[model samples]
Target: MNNAKKYNIKIAIAVALLLSAASFTFLEKQEINSKDNLMEVLYALGQDYPEHYIEKPDSANIKRGYELIHVGKTKSADGIASKAISKFYTCTSCHNVEREDLDLTLVDQDARLEYAMENKLPYLQGSTFWGIVNRESWYNDDYILKYGSLVDDAKNSLKGSIQLCATVCSQGRELEDWEMTSILSYLSTLQMKVEDLELNIAEFEQMNSLAESNPDSAIAFIKSHYLSKSPATFAELPESKEKGYSFEGRPQYGKAIYELGCQHCHHAYGESDLVLDNSVLTFRWLKKHMPDNSKKSIYEIIRKGSYSELGHKEYMPNYTLEKMSHRQVEDLRAYIESNVK
Candidate 1:
């Protein structure tokens, strides 16, 4: 064969091989996705009670419950009081089922409690639901156990607690009966599944890489992935008139901002700790520790974030313009000041 013909054939062969490899990779990815879907379905089916049980969950209902827990929302709103209305936050926002690699302890005390609690380490949301199925009572303090109440006594009962979370924490309307049942059914499935505890580090690595290039897209992708995993059980309801925050003044607005952002680490009013920097940032603590209690200094700290004297960035994430506006920061300052005795 001529030299040109020989080279042409070689190039063609290489191109063919490349296409074949690409096809194989695509098929492998499809197979992995199919397996993931199958596993999820099986997991849902396993949630059903045995024949001996008088009340058993339907697989479809169980799956719907999963969706409700992970992504269901009645409306969409903004700001702190409007948070409960947001579609972005759900039960999974605080009660996660997955294991992540980050040292969450640096951000929240709930994560540190894992060492003392063993398999009960907090979920990514800073609390674990492992063996939650066996717990006769819910909540960290066990309101039911201590108060001898059922799950609907308000804030104390499981149903009441769920309602409070929806209204206060999420800043949305109360969950409907079907939605509650679906969520409870899903929670009932939270057993000590050793295999599920295995962390998908690769997923996190991919997310980190994407976040570096496109943070907004990365956030959307994560939310979409979770949402797609569980189809919504109900149509989007009309937005409720309930204002998430009273907004009596700037301090209330700031409290809303604090609840939305800082509360995850600082916790409640008096629950701040040194490890999480909560103690230093609480309204009272900040007033005592900071020579200047002005809003400007507080805003600067939040905007730039706190670092150790050694120049190391603390675990607390910075609040950039992209994350919160200056007005919001001012409100946060107002909220902190209000907390002061």
Candidate 2:
């Protein structure tokens, strides 16, 4: 198949892990507590972004996320909070959300039949992609594993491509990149819904079975069922009140600016091993290389960008930076000074 299609198959398999690593790398040392301000998180991300999204992540992340999805980009928002809603804990964990393990009724098992059919293949070797993503114990795909594909004989042409990608490339399919943006948007707009959400399911079921029980208890459980994945309520979170970093008061206004703008992809705050200077200065590899500028002259390589797909793997979007005001740029410069010196 073509390179784009090949990329699709590969991305489908391990997109989650890649996205997780990419988003978490900056915060590798920080905890993602529920209490942290969304703007703080957004600001930090703006600063440490992969250079592809340096200018404005809220705008860029959603925009880029949608672009990928429109073209069948699959890996973008797998790690976005809306899709995850706190991992491993089910509604039964607290009744604030929903049942313990997700209702089996909601799962589609078609991928399983497809997998079983694959085991019958003699030429279908193994997968490096699977080695990375598959925990080995869990089924490859819950939905696909349970139900078989509904492909007709005429559409069988797509089968070889799918099988080849799954076996050899090891890409996964589920949350597409574009869906990630929508998910992020949902997360960005999140406000808690149900208040007394937790259900005493046992109490609930018992009440339902009783001839005369507290109507309120039954009402509570029924109410909780609908809010299984309700994120922390808007009331619980201080974020519902619009909060932004005030530029005038903070001593580290530069840091705030950097967090809000430059830190995403460039090595402004600290030198990273991935980027290069005019002299191609890297720590050890180009050991003796020299440059004339003792003072680092920073410039916006990508106006709205952090990196380039044209060739630079900077991951920083270029056009986005063009939107910045001059004061913001100077603020970023001052922020970098603390790290630069």
Candidate 3:
């Protein structure tokens, strides 16, 4: 052959090999993606898959649900306004609609505090409503202690739990059929996505490789990354020494918790009779009561929240150790005491 012909043949052969390799790689990726729809994987693993989960929820239902959650009322399809679900508290009073923790796996309050401050979300007593749809159970752990017989029905059934919260916990009436459907549709929109998983590159590759042959391993691995249920362990008020009274609390963090956690229901136009603001009077009252073991003290009120009485249907929900740490409670104290006039 001529020298030019030999060179052209070599180039053609190399190009063919490259194209063949690229095609194989593309096919491999396509196969992986087909199997790696985490939602399907979770469903196959018997992960409490909903009967009907739509990728896109109905916009009007979502709007009504959102309004109901935030304001305790919404308009029906006919443009008629529904009655308030609760006169005292809306869903947002104790729960944030957005994600609170930076890492989904860790329920660490400090990390959650940082994320809440960064994202401008309330550091609430209840778990965030962001991924509530994906969670297998609700009103978990020591919540049974407070709810008593009510928790029995709600422990496993999402709809049952929603009704429990609406009627018992929130002191509202039982939700109507349409209202229940709308709220659930809204929650379904908040289901966890694949990006929320903590898979490393190597782990992702392993899952991709093992997807067909050893799929159970990948399923279990994904499940391990996040909790199916939020834990709630109620704690007692700390003793004087264990309260970390000596340690200087971070006022900046404390301020965020106060505004986001406390003032959400305790400010002017908020749900609480004991209104809280930047006013000197509020600060002074909190400071004066801090040394005592009264409900007015942050230490007492936070750990041992008030319960509903005959006349008082509205009551404070106690913070779980998982929800608010001892340090964060102290941080709240520092912030309140700092503002004392």
Candidate 4:
């Protein structure tokens, strides 16, 4: 080949390489800039995405909220205590503060039991407060039947629901405005982190790609990954004497439900007078009285929870099908039988 042709070919290849390097640099810069947008988009669409969340929660307010939830009262820096929120129950009596299920979309009792065991938390009736701020609805499903007209006002409003729980559910008075603000501020701090979504690589890429051009689609996509609201369905007590599952129940799993779910409210430091420890007597009592039509039976009590009378304001909340499955109840029976034997 001619020397002039060879020189032209070398120059062409050099320009191509330089252009490729410049393109790579530009793409890297674009990705870096989009990182912030990625977080914004994820949080907007992620689980527990409340309509409005405080970006910065006040530490003082958070402490007050914490105290109110665990203790049902707030204390001043000077150590004076505010009026108790409830005579019967604190928020922690029924609700957990952390995530309960492996997947936010799942409402399985077995999975929740496992989660509780893992996290050292008690299995309770109410949903967790971890993402309460993000939930669009509250006091859902059968709650309407219990609360009646009150549910109407609380269903769509978080503040309303809080008030309903405080007055009716907790058997407490209405919260002061500042108290409400502080509780909300504390809940805001519990917003789900981006990592909680567990987005895969391709999903992360899609999120990044749509972070700017079409955020609505991205938001919908992420929302689809987790439940926007926890569901509740009441289960009727079994008609016949037999309530066991066809398959054998796992006594180990049932043991957890007994300890975390039953013992949580029955033992010392719990809400109930009935003391259920790791005793053979408790097991024998459960085995003999297991799940009949009687309200004292495990099955009947779980399905049709007892109502509070004038003398007792604190009452057991019935477990929804979503909270405790038929299989789980059978498992509890199996556990009791095992202990009795």
Candidate 5:
């Protein structure tokens, strides 16, 4: 029982107590139980998604930044600063967790099908979600290998990954350039939810722009990022053989990737607000729910939630798969790299 769970329990109990004498008493209690279960489920999920959820730190600053991102970084500067001070981390640093016992990711094809069929929820098409948020989240998760977690990586670079992730998760951080630089400076050291950074346009643009300014640095980033996975590296593609790897390029992949992996609740044609945040292509609803999308395609996002405008909806789905097809994912990646709109 972590403190978040404990507190949630107290909140649930308080609600139950308040509604004890109501006319729909039984229903209220049932609802309370369900809510409590949801919280517990979330706690279990946090443990499962050790990548997305942060155990509130002893440091006040750390907790504050967590809260700021929770409320959407673009929406809360004071909160982010307060939290950053204590935790001395970034949005991507503390999100990935090792315990897979309670995650709720829904990237498995079969599980996703079942989820869509059973729940009255509808997002399984191809219209929602910003490509940017998911793109960052995916990269960060994969980046885990080189940087040993986004938090540590953030400590050294301060600017590249951290700022981009913060912008997406917060739906759009409201930081001035200098503030962003400072925030980003602290963000790299974070080690929890880098996997959950939102795939928003803001974050991706920032990251891409940063990369553009320093091609050598960008290449180094990509190299380190890919190396983390220890994938078979080519003797080296002629640097000119391909255009490049980037956040913009990732969305092309993200669009198709989500179509196959997360179209269940994040459909293209729907009654819901299931659309990309002009950022990464994965659905916002799905991004926050499952940070570890092994079903993730090339340029997969490694971030989390966004602002009300970008995400603009509620309800997170769970997609879980122990394994994914590399060839299939590669196909999607190739297309995104070559022909993303």
Candidate 6:
């Protein structure tokens, strides 16, 4: 072949190789994105229903056991046995299924849910049950200080843990032997199969430190780092605002606050009978019991907390202005008013 013909062939071959490399790069990126998306969904599902994701031996007793743990009571507990108790706090109350990471003070209502569902958010103190079965010891901190190290024997440790939780946290009666066995069996299902995504603790701590001084910017930092999304991305979503409130006081926004702050104690949804306590606060109960209470009253109760007519401080902790602002209080009030039926 002539020099000119050879040069043309070389150019054609070079172009072909470049095209192949570009195609491969595109496919590889697409694959990575797909895996990331799948992982996000799986993480969200596991957080939302750790019990459903965990593997367990199939059995009638196991099924019943799972139900009992989830509900905080058995089917047999009814009538006066149920009515005498004011609340029915359960395992799920403190150990919520999903991790909540959104800084509700900054994120709008819908974006908060979207981020949570997308596995970009983290929960507060509630320990996720996803890997509880594998834990060598149960209660941490003060419980260890009080009870000594968790019992070594798996069965005994579980039983002791349940006993402490029931008698101490719930302030309720002890579980029967059968109840313990069933619940333990159910717990066994919660062993972790894969590592779960966790919030960057350092980043979270920084947000906390900044929260008192620059609450808005602190939330923006959380959105950018922990959520792996730009703060501006959330801003583009439709604004959900209430007329009288300084911040967005949409019921949805209130719902997020309630879920994080109140729902664990209040037990408004599902089988009200299964709640940890019957006397736990609910919007309807509040309206009836404290008919004279206004938004200011609610805000004060949240900020300073409440005391019984007998002068004893109530179970709730005071949410200081640092932790929750007046705007959040308004959102909570909006949520309560809308939910009262």
Highest lDDT against the true fold, candidate: 3
Q: lDDT (CA) for every model shown?
A: 0.40, 0.28, 0.74, 0.72, 0.31, 0.43
TM-score of each: 0.33, 0.23, 0.84, 0.83, 0.26, 0.39
lDDT of 1 by residue, 1-341 (tens): 47985576455434423322222121233112211222232223233332111134454445555555644532211221112233335565555544322332122222323332344322222234433442223333332332244334443245665665565444457776766665565554553221232327676565445545665554443433321111111111112212212233366545545554455545433222432233435457654533343322444355444322343322332343423444554555556566665
What does candidate 6's lDDT look like per residue over 191-300, in tens digits? 32221223355654554455446645643553343222112110111122233345656676566666655645555463222242223365665444332343224553
lDDT for residue 293 in candidate 5, whole number 0-100: 31
Error of 2 at 210 (Å): 46
The candidate with the higher lDDT, 3 or 5, is: 3
**Looking at model 1, how many pairs of residues clash?**
9
Tell me the TM-score of model 5. 0.26
Question: How big is the RMSD of model 4?
Answer: 16.3
Report clashes for each candidate as comma-separated counts. Answer: 9, 59, 0, 1, 95, 15
Residue range 1-341, candidate 4, lDDT tens digits: 47985576455434423322222121234332222322234554333434445445456666677667766888755677789999888898889877788887666677788888898888777888877876788888888887788988788888898999999888889998778877886676555544566777888687657755675776676667677788888887766546554546788988888888998889886788878888898888877777456766888788777777799887888888888888888888888888886
lDDT of 3 at 285: 86
Please report the TM-score between candidate 6 and the true structure.
0.39
Return the candidate ranking by lDDT, descending: 3, 4, 6, 1, 5, 2
**Model 1, global lDDT:** 0.40
Error at 84, model 2, angstroms: 14
Q: Give the per-residue Cα lDDT of candidate 5 at 309.
A: 39
Local lDDT at 202 for model 2? 60
Q: Could you say which candidate leads in TM-score?
A: 3
Q: What's the true lDDT of residue 107 in model 2?
A: 21
Ranking by TM-score: 3, 4, 6, 1, 5, 2
Query: What tens digits encode model 5's per-residue C-alpha lDDT throughout 1-341?
Result: 38995586455434433322223221233111211212122232221322322222222333333334322232233443322321222332223211111122323433433333344323221111111111222332333433245444343333444443454332334345544433322222232222232324554454344444654453343223211211111121112213323213234434444453444324344222444332434433333333233323122331111213343522221211122233323333444434323
Q: What is the lDDT of residue 194 in candidate 6?
A: 20
